[model samples]
Target: MLETEKEKVKKDAEALQLKMYINGEWKEASDQKTRDVINPATGAVIAEAPEGTAEDAQAAIAAAKATFESGVWSDLPATERAAYLLKIADKIDEKAEELTKLETMDNGKTLREAGYDVGDAAACFRYYAGMITQPDGHTYHVADPMQAMVVREPVGVCGLIVPWNYPLLMSVWKIAPALAAGNTIVFKPSEVTPVTPTKLLEIFEEVGLPAGVANMVMGAGPVVGNEIASHKDVDMVSFTGGTKTGKHIMKTAADTMKKVSLELGGKSPNIIFADSDFETAVDYALFGIYAGAGQVCSAGSRILVEESIYEKFLARFAERAKEIRVGDGSDSKTEMGPLVSQEHLDKVLSYIEIGKEEGARLLCGGERLISDGLDKGYFVAPTAFADTTQEMRIVQEEIFGPVVAIQPFKDEEEAIRLANDSDYGLAGAVFTVDGAKGLRVIKKLRAGITWINSYHPTYNEAPWGGYKQSGIGRSLGTFGLEEFQEVKQININLEVEPIGWFEK
Candidate 1:
């Protein structure tokens, strides 16, 4: 961008104020503090978000609690709630262009990637809208004169905290389901990318969603997010972020015994066998890690290849990795975009250095891009370190960047062992022409989402989460909607008469 373009963004930032939405009213923080939101693609300040504090977070939670207790939204008929969700979904579609641009500017993902996420966000609202209308309670058969049945109700206020990697998509993953289930919400979008989610709050208001049905407080996690988690009024917290932070939230939420659903980090593995369709395996290997700049929680950063095809596979993967176009996300021709922020780019670069120090082979690009209009942006080339061991930090830890740690396995058994050796069980994929082997291997792999010949195709109808450290509970499909609900058993007596064994 030219000097004038950068200056114009600064001017826009000065004019725009992303305020906090509470009780259907847009307001500033109590102290009137603000934080400049920088565009990672251009390293320019695009806008400013209200830097909310713990008091602000408390106010949001109180509003959610009050609204839930009032039953204005929670007690609405299922069809009514469903209609609101559908409306929000429709609004998202109507405003996809604006939201996508904000997402790209705030999160530094390609326009196409942001566009895909915007579509998925809309689908999430629609999915929950339809799912909520389905039968969820159960009728039971009992003995004697008693009739018993189970009914579901909303679980008061929900504390929704989402990550920056998928700014809008992740927010909808929690918001739509929480609303569909009739629970009021205290939402906290990541401080890094609060722009898109703030716009979502607008859509919620535009659709006439009741005040406090969905409230947003934007600030640092320790202040706003922790306040929501530890608040007694907040009944549940559905957080999607790093594993360490997930653990912290679990501990804090345990004080109030609030239900905690976490979708944490992963060092996912992508396996390629010699017998697999070679071209397809190579293509997905690139897509798995490079997509979202490898910032995905379920990103396949660990590529485990069979010994027979290790050398051939790594060469092709590295060749493709080097060619991924990295620049401003708004550029239609760019295939890859910069990291979300300068700090994150430094973290990814440090991981690359650690990979080299640990005696791994740098087969392709590993340097930060400082030329071709990318000098100001936080851009790094798609990097891969081959001949990695399981003990290496690059192999075990979640780098959350366009960096892959490639390792070779001797056989099928070793492949399975290598895949499941991580502390995370978020996602994994295996590529092989043998369908039976794919199933067999995938079954043994300890992850929540898996693919036979594919890489990244997640559905809203299916459960989305992981085992072990990946998360505590599921967050998509029926399971996701159920997370914000409570179950109650109601029994009625068919006959009022009773026989007494002892004389009165």
Candidate 2:
């Protein structure tokens, strides 16, 4: 690369770095406090973002309310709304490289994974764009022959809180549907990985969304996030994060009777039966537990294997775990990267200690990788444990890292029982060659989504949520769009007579 080209690239990266976006303008937080964004791969400060405060959050909510009241975004034709969303998608596509680089720099995810997430974000908006004008309602006949129609309307201003694990994808997951339903939005990107959304806001302007229709406020949970949840002007709050935080958002939203939707924590199960294709099941099991450094909310961190094949499976699984490359996310050869932050790394390490105290057998990779060449980053070796009992801490709690706990179940009934024993019911997978057995297992599973003979397969058109503590309300597909809307019924009578003398 030439010197001029290198300078241009540096300038481009700097231009994409952001402080905050309130209303229609990019500005610093009211506190003027800034936080350094670290490259998880190297533990070096790469950029700084304004640490937003409660005042900035209130301003964002006010902007959303003002935009809604002005009727600029609300009164636009649904087709025009859809067009704007598509344009946003186009803009994202244009800046894919920059967004992907920023995500990898901020979140410690591989460029490949970040690139794919950015693409998924674009696809989500495009999918919602087509759905914006398609919310047609149904009409029914009445015994009195009076006309009646049901209509779906936007649910006013929406407060979206995204998680750090999949920053861009989670943002799109909430933002796309809320906008599709004609709702203006005030969003708070997770402080740990705020870069992608800031880049997204830059694209929003180029795409020509009306002022205040879309906004971003960057800050921590207690400050900006709480304001979004409790603000009276914000009619709805959709959050994706930990269960503890999700509960707080739910409680705060209740103060104002605001609508709330949450996609919270999961201790999802991935069951591998004796009859499954051993090689395929092993790969699926690995990916389920280890991908994204196992930060995924729906990560299948618990592995339930048939007792008959448990020993053999453990050996192969451990062998594969050793082969997983742990290094900089920028390296194409690297299969896994560091966890998002040192705090998260320490938390996961604590859980590993608990697993040992509770007597679960540590199979392999329990310690952090402290090579002389790589000392600064927050890196943990991909970990796996076998002989894990249901009561073991590792088996029961969510170790959101490259950690997997294997428990051997005796039979189909026992497998189902163990899988549903957790407080979460987000996603699960059953690997079996027998078609009837796979279907039967899926039927008995308690999760909202079950994958048979496969794992982690999701679609933009499928409804996603949980059956129990995993979450309330669904996201993705047409069902996702409905979460940001309320239903209204309209009636017109062609011929009606006044019951009394007060007819006009």
Candidate 3:
């Protein structure tokens, strides 16, 4: 067959065979039910995934527990653990194109973004693979003159729940570190976008990870996700999603007294000072929110521009926002794509309405676009609202769409106050020319990760989580590795000790 024919055949095959992986096996849903994975750009069905149930989640938990108890994964040498993660990374690299394409089809993100996500997923595995061999344990000097040491051991049977926005990357964020720390995992991918994870399981099997060491079950939060969070056999639960769902997971894990790590919602603020580099700040501010269709948890959705440059910034920002091309993710020229679902699209639209009602000026876009050929897609024009107040719903609530609200602040104090006024404080950004002012603002900003003149620049080596409702505990870096471990102290006697005077 010709190369074009082979390519067509591959795409066809990807659209057909959607399965769920549970207990290290790929199978159809027990009820044979399937959910249609829609292409948000065209509002068309891209694929079908098995609609998993609570029973599937229970089976996956059982499998993970049994695998952890078997000691194969735990007893494996750190080098061996690193080798397995490396193998998984290699498999991901080999299937990068397939995974990226699947993500674009299912998640309504641009091909460029999906491509980046695939690379990031691989890098996550590779990073954890390298970290597994690092020295872990601390040595302490005791005043009592006895040798004291503390060691970290794996907490068994972790439950990972990833959100739909960045399905593959988020899963890797949880899976790599948990496994690197010597814990087996039962992962539950979002039911709305489950194709990439199903393919990921095939890669795990191809890479020869032991059965049940890594498992995935697809279902909604109420069913599969809740079961994983509440399962008695699960030693820890790491979740990345909305704040409300994170709360539910925390509550459920509390029943079992399981360790929980959450990376939840954010209404992050991007404070652009008058003295900052206007062009750079504008660019970072736009990408921080509009990238990924603004579904990111750390998206700088709230824009706090200094009053001196408020008008100047809004004009340029709105112009740039209007230039963004909203189209199908498969198109290389498309800069933005539709929101994940019609419901989410409507929610965003309602927020726009609320913004208007709350008296924020709709400076650029306020409604869905109905271009000549774009009527069928769930496309919203990249929107900008000027004169937004901190009390406005658009400024306070997370729209989670390509919608930005710009509010003017009198000075640094007001900016910091407005920035920290939200219930969510996952991340924030400070843009200014003066390094001193930037540092001072960062010190006062109540956020987990604060970017100085930059936004959304994350690394595997940095610890990530929030101070308040954004999350509990951290992920990535050594902090993330510690999340999967429990500390134990061993005290040794260097010399014989005398009895107490009273006893004598």
Which residue pairs collide, candidate 3?
none
Candidate 2 per-residue C-alpha lDDT over 1-504 given as tens digits, one digit per residue, 9 for 90 to 100: 112222334432643356688778998878566666777888876766777889999998899999998989887889999999899999889989988888898899998898999999999999999887675898878756478889888999999999889888889999999988889999998888888888888888887788899989988889999999988999999998888899888989999999999988889999889999999999999899888989988888999999999999999999999999988888887789899988898999999888888888899988888795457888999898888888787887777899989989999999999999998899999999999988898888889988987778678899888878888999999889889999999887767877577766
**Per-residue lDDT for 172 in model 2?**
92
Clashes per candidate, residues 3 or more apart or on different chains = 0, 0, 0
Would you list the C-alpha lDDT of every candidate in the order shown? 0.91, 0.87, 0.87
Clashes of 3: 0
Candidate 1 Cα misplacement greater than 4 A, ranges:
1-15, 499-503
Residue pairs whose backbone atoms clash in candidate 2: none
Off by over 4 Å in 2: 1-17, 501-504
Worst lDDT run of 10 residues, candidate 1, spans 1-10
* Index of the highest-TM-score prediction: 1
lDDT of 3: 0.87
Show the lowest summed lDDT stretch of 10 residues, model 3. Answer: 1-10
